[model samples]
Target: MPHDHPMTVDAMLKQEFWEALYQRDDRIWSGNVNVNLQTEVEGLKPGRALDLGCGEGGDAIWLARHGWTVDGADISTTALARAEAAGREAGVTVDWLHRDILSWRPEDAYDLVSAQYMHLPPALRRDVFTAAAAAIRPGGSLLVVGHSPKAMRQFDGQKPPEELFFEPEEITGYLGDAWQWLVETCETRGEGHHTDAVYRARRLEA
Candidate 1:
């Protein structure tokens, strides 16, 4: 099952490609919050949330339903439109922003900023993750999850690019002294040999 490639240059071309991908199907993802996300946030009190690369808005909707006001950001307009409709159907409201994560800058910090499975070029990913960590309010959390490098060997057919895969530390290392690590680990999923690197950290109170 091919997934949408990470954003590239040629802004218009990238948007059209992703839009077509989303329009080709009724849904692109499982339409449920990521297990890692669910596990990490299950105990935290709801607050202002930002779902980066929210695609189809699953995480955003989940956050909203759980009492957090959510802002879902994605590059594809079609995906955002579908997410908005899904939010309405789910009886929760999400502020959908049509923007690329690479260029997006939040006007305000969030209590929870999540970027799940957001695969981008190394430099761009580092920049975005750094900015995301910086956007967490004091005593808030930042969760970053992505495909582990081991997945390249585990799923030979997929052959994802090296730059797209990373270890939990690659993300967590971007955090400065302001953050406290809560969880940093990698685990394999059943059967497919799929692996995910998860990093959840809290911004220390200033």
Candidate 2:
């Protein structure tokens, strides 16, 4: 009966992996805005922001404090709970939605949509990133950061699946001609070994 569950096997695996990780620690990610996100967003005017795969609300809280109305979404209920608590602790309000990025459909466009280190199987990654792109309002910005394929060697003994890695182009290429690329590059961090592919683009007015 378990094997014949309603959810697809891939969905089950994705949930299991993230849930187990969240359970293993009080927090799986640092309670700080990702460096790339902070850097990329520093100059942009704040507005309605959507944070995809937002783990623990660090970035969302940061955006809220900087005058943006933030909506943070993640698949893991545990992570969403922590994110809500973090938002409270920061004295900022973030709309925390427990939803998988791969299947999410935004009801409204946002001035900024950010997905930091949102790695998934290639198919899922393309789908979610494309959707995120589409959710950006004209003249709005989209920022995506992911583990670059080059970082695979930095995993020590517990290497992630190769398919979870992506190049910046893979994400940027998903956008249509309406987007103007801003930042597209890879950068190393943390002992100069862990590299991330960072992409930032702005949608043109129709």
Candidate 3:
């Protein structure tokens, strides 16, 4: 069955949207490193990593600090510049690319690919997942984290209403029948609008 709801906000392509969303507010996403990001990826050996929609480069810096070559991609040059500055300050090198995910392509495969809080419209979301899955090497992993549908009621923020946010089942459908489900859980975190749904899935080699 096809979901009829529009899944994406198209926030990446609009310069003004990014300017308003990112420009005067260059700071770490979530105001700190993603707790789940640290714990979930700690077990995997660091290698080439891609941070899709990397805002201010928090995760990218963290990954680079952990010994992975990080590519931080975002549509806002202002954001990318800020990320680069942070990377330099941290003494960690991260390749910052100002490219919209909808138009960007992987130059090569990666050991890890992550898209956090990038809630694309349904069709675009599927396209991105498929691309991200394909970009991972045989033994690599892919991670996506988004606002849970419940967040609409649990908190208040810019996140879309319940109708737009994702559910575990919806995410599973996006993964298709090909990827191996390593972890699928819906939980709340932070205060107010900070609560979100975190999901992690792995693509099998065989």
Residues forming the 10-long window of minimal summed lDDT in candidate 2? 1-10
TM-score of 3: 0.81
Q: What TM-score goes with each of the models?
A: 0.86, 0.86, 0.81
Of models 1 and 3, which has the larger lDDT?
A: 1
Which regions of candidate 1 fall more than 4 Å away from where they truly are? 1-13, 153-158, 178-192
Off by over 4 Å in 3: 1-13, 26-31, 153-163, 176-194
Encode model 3's per-residue lDDT on 15-86: one tens digit a residue. 556655665444535535677788668988888999998878888999999999999998878788888888
* Predicted candidate 1 versus true structure: per-residue lDDT over 1-206, tens digit per residue: 22454333333235676777788788988899999899989898899999998999999999999999999999999899989999999999999999877877787899999999887778888888888987888878888888877766523145546777777777766676633644433343432336777778887776
- Stretch of 10 with least lDDT, candidate 1: 4-13
TM-score of 2: 0.86
Clashing pairs in 2: none
lDDT of 2 at 167: 77
Q: Which should have the higher TM-score, number 1 or number 3?
A: 1
Error of 3 at 205 (Å): 3.2
